[model samples]
Target: MSVRLRLAALGVAAATAAAGLALVTAPAAVALDNGLARTPQMGFNNWNATHCSGDFNETMVKGIADLFVSSGLKAAGYQYVNLDDCWALPARDAGGNLVPDPVRFPDGIKAVADYVHAKGLKFGLYSSAGTKTCNTAGFPGGLGHEKQDAALWASWGVDYLKYDNCNNQGVDAVQRYTAMRDALAATGRPILYSLCEWGQNQPWNWATSVGNSWRTTGDINDTYAKMLSIFKANIKLGQYAGPGHWNDPDMLEVGNGGMTDTEYRSHFSLWSIMASPLLIGSDIRKATPATMAILTNKDVIAVDQDPLGVQGTELSNANGLHVISKPLAGGDRAVALFNENGTPATISTTAAAVGLPKALGYQLNDLWSHKTTETAGKISATVPAHGTAMFRVHAGGAWWSNPPAVHTSADLPLPYPGAPALVQPGTTTTLTTTTTNDGVLPGLLGEVKLTGPAGWTVKATSPTFHPVLPAGRDVSTKWSVSTPADTPPGSYPLHVSTTYYPGKSTSDYDLTVSVAAPLTAGTTGLGDDPWLSADNGYGPVERNTSNGESKAGDGHPITLGGVTYAKGLGVNAPSTITYYPAGHCSAVTATVGLDDEKTGAGSVTFEIWADGNKVADTGLIKRGDPAQSLHADVTGAGLLRLIVTDGGDGNTNDHADWANAQITC
Candidate 1:
């Protein structure tokens, strides 16, 4: 089944599963925690600004907390001052309670909380739900002391708690987390709990009842690729997002340097549509004017804080051109037109295309321009290359001062039909639809009639505009026919006609349907895993082999069998490497690159090992070369080993590379 179908099936019981997975206890009733459910969270997290370098001493936090009130952020609806990781010392006091690091937070967390609370803003703190504080610089982990930690936070006046999955792992991840959730409740403090487990456990399906929101992906970097990837990855989880619970794609990367202003606006637009937490990660003290404008765009922010709280959905995509439409409060709709290709292309669609009913008329409000104007019935526009156009459609004058804009459509139903169409059997196709109402009015609807040859049946129906157009609005609709399975493998012409009312404009569009037989495509074996290698002088160097030498990073590969043991496969090199494998393998194992602290890239080779034996070994090598890289294949059920030798072949003493290698997968 499709991923969407799977998620829909799982959506119903997702909360129950979360409740079962979460640690349950009588929850605390802290007064400061009651406001989150009523508003879209607006706050600050230090990770994007300072990362692991985040510090929260009296001097630093007092200044930040003061800035929270003075910087207009508080007035603009930002109230939470969250301290993310790295502020705690290694151990707790004799009372078995976690304590702030004296060097970093000398005044004590309670004092800091008091100061923040006095400023009219709430204070938030971080911790892990595991035995070890998350990977932050010694942030405390409330493993065995969940209840104690929860009480401490409440006593300290914390209004929000960011519970992360720092050192916690294994099958019991759910239970370990639930323990902290229940503990926080016992404190009688209604802290706005947040889950930061990076979505590994599909938190959206079960995180709402436990916390306000959960990170749906790994920490996002300050780059366009990183930001966009996280955004796109959460699209499938849209159904689970709402006012009380949200799917977090991590904090904003707006002014952190990897993109341009337009891109940032696009970023904010998408986030708004997704109803994601508007937690600014940039340094508020030094925010450039441009960055502030992007973050504080009143129009976009309005959409984010919209009362309806419905997340946007992907309407359609053809040949790299994509469209997403969202419903806004006050009978309006938000549409995002995008071009994901290298070249510029025209992305045209009517109000009806997104499912605005015929009874409604819409005015296109350019969010960036902050201007509201009538579309003159011209709801289509061309999108630029690698760019986007975002507009807020206000229904006919209901909420807007002006009327909808109008542009003439000379080629009645432009783009002459009889075009080659690809249709799935048993599925009805939606034809291009449009709306005439321009300003602040509801959507309209027209009739769609389809004519196809005998034997064709309509299994499912769709509007050229998704979200069926609401009634009583001024809108239009087109129709498409679904062909039958027994139809011959040839072109079959079908007709799609629309009848507009009042004005009574009749238009007919033709589509050439091809009943092409489905054919199976050939496949290839698994591609080489980036983690393993069999090149250079490092080929399956058996642990007990005479020629093999045990080296620093190469000593004792963790496992006994599987690709995890591949010789040159370990990444002790300075470069970042991400290890993932195909299939339902139990573990993934590899050794570190044994090269000495020296830097510079060159040929690096390694051998592949499975079940403690050599499976594939490479020839003469070099790093970056297709053939010289580490490659491996191993059973998901067992161990693997690799004994890599640094530099090139025989005779020359190599930098400390791998030798005594083993891995557990």
Candidate 2:
């Protein structure tokens, strides 16, 4: 006895727009306020688990809905039971209304919606924003019939909509998606609108006011590279996300079999920190124990559902190791350390480097291992290959007092002017940081300890300067810092700490040193520009390196002075590079090119501004085009700025490079 025949037959009423029904369009200045999904939406979708199999019938949906209640998933905040593609009839009925497949959905969509509602769960339906869905299933997409479809779904009590992109006939994405948004608003129903356009149109820039959650990348497979690539792309778009608007990096592939458990943990942890929607794409009816454990971990989920709604940012991606940090609502922070290398390695970072206050100690709670420990600013974890170590850090207490006010400043012999002191790899540089005591009583200046990145030798030359510092007195210490010859180009943290009496209070001074790649002759106009190697809001400028064709910035190759030189500054579109002369250079010039070796289907517009004035503007440069030469007379200019934007098509492969760049003093 098949469950389809045993269920009572049901009919769906045709839905039509009323006469003189004013179409409620999305507000230009704000997003649709459905008052739902204020945080990332949690639920179950059947795409990764069961993609359009014949068993995707009303009975299976009902079974999943029942499990949602019985298996305690609802209690854990998993609500929506979404049906992906293939639940609809091949074509519309006589009245041009969408029809569910008779054999699969014997009781119609409204009945399923009602049943899901009866269990206190929401019902979600999937449709293509294009002419047809990804598969040739019965689903007739809502391309030309957005109004009709929105009305029907609203009438059927649908609570959520996962609108995908497939077979869109060269139509503009913003227009089609905005049409659906306006149509859904016209229905006067509070449906959660999800934009699934595969992140093709840079929806993070335009879709905030249109949908609740917009996918920021293409579909994610259950592989390590696919999952990691999606995570990297989404993390960079954090500035565009907030409450009511989110950057969706596709659904969760945590329970899928393509990756190991360690890699899956990394996937889930990164996604949680990024505040992406935690829609599980696994079969909930028979979830494995490990999958269920990862999914139901409330501590990890709390990070995603944090009330602050701020997305995390990548702190570092050097040497195949990555660190990400997110600020929580209660002044706590979430940090994730990912080891992308093939071999297991020990990685460490300081709380100050992740934007925590330097003077305060922190209590760290491992979100995955559930271990708790307290640290005096330094945190270290040995992670497995392709694994992640995540922690929630709470401010424990202040280690230093107000009486012993310590003022610190760094002095480098050959300063790069306005930028931080530069330390070339394989060279010893003496870093002198002076600490001044402005307290009421004398204090002892104890030993100074310096901690930096791995493979770097940082020793305090004046370790035991037990000088009695009277009130209003100051003392200086020097550290001999040396980097390995093969250190990657980035800003590495150089943390300086020491304990002094009367109370033996710990004083900490945090600073950064720029490590530049050995530049070749004739590569730049200036011998070694400090601003070119340091991180200035945008990530550290990599010399002569291609961000590579694989979107994840893997296997980067070197570029030199030629038009096809292996390295320069590589950036996606909508990025800015500002260089402060720091009184070091008077004029700057560079050859900007769209990398012919790495870029595909990328177009960019480059602009140069000197002292707030537009100096040069390259209208548009497409892939394989000749490089654009530009020069700027930056005499007496306080700042020089370079802006790169997508050539009116959204940033897909907008890999831009700066070649033969130089500055003249």
Which candidate's lDDT is highest?
2
- Any runs in candidate 1 off by more than 4 Å, and if so which? 1-35, 54-56, 169-171, 341-345, 376-378, 381-386, 398-665
Candidate 1 local Cα displacement, residue 263, angstroms: 1.5
For candidate 1, write residues 1-665 as lDDT tens digits: 22332343243522221211211111121212334644457788887777565344557777878887776777777788888777777777799888787777878888888998899999889888876675644555877789888888898999888888867745355566667778887887778878888887777655555567778876665544445556677655666776667778788877765566656776787777777888888777777888888887777877778887766767677865667777766667777876653233446566766656554445778777664555433455434334566788754564334433321111112111211234446655554434333334333334555566777753224454323223324344444455665565565655555443323333343444444332212221111332321222221222222122223234344221122332432232111121222222332333333233223444434555444356655543443233223345554513233433333321122222332332323
In candidate 2, what residue range of length 10 has the lowest lDDT sum?
4-13
TM-score of each: 0.58, 0.58
- What lDDT, from 0 to 1, does candidate 2 have? 0.71
Off by over 4 Å in 2: 1-29, 397-665
Instruction: Give the deviation of candidate 1 from the true structure as CA RMSD.
Output: 17.3
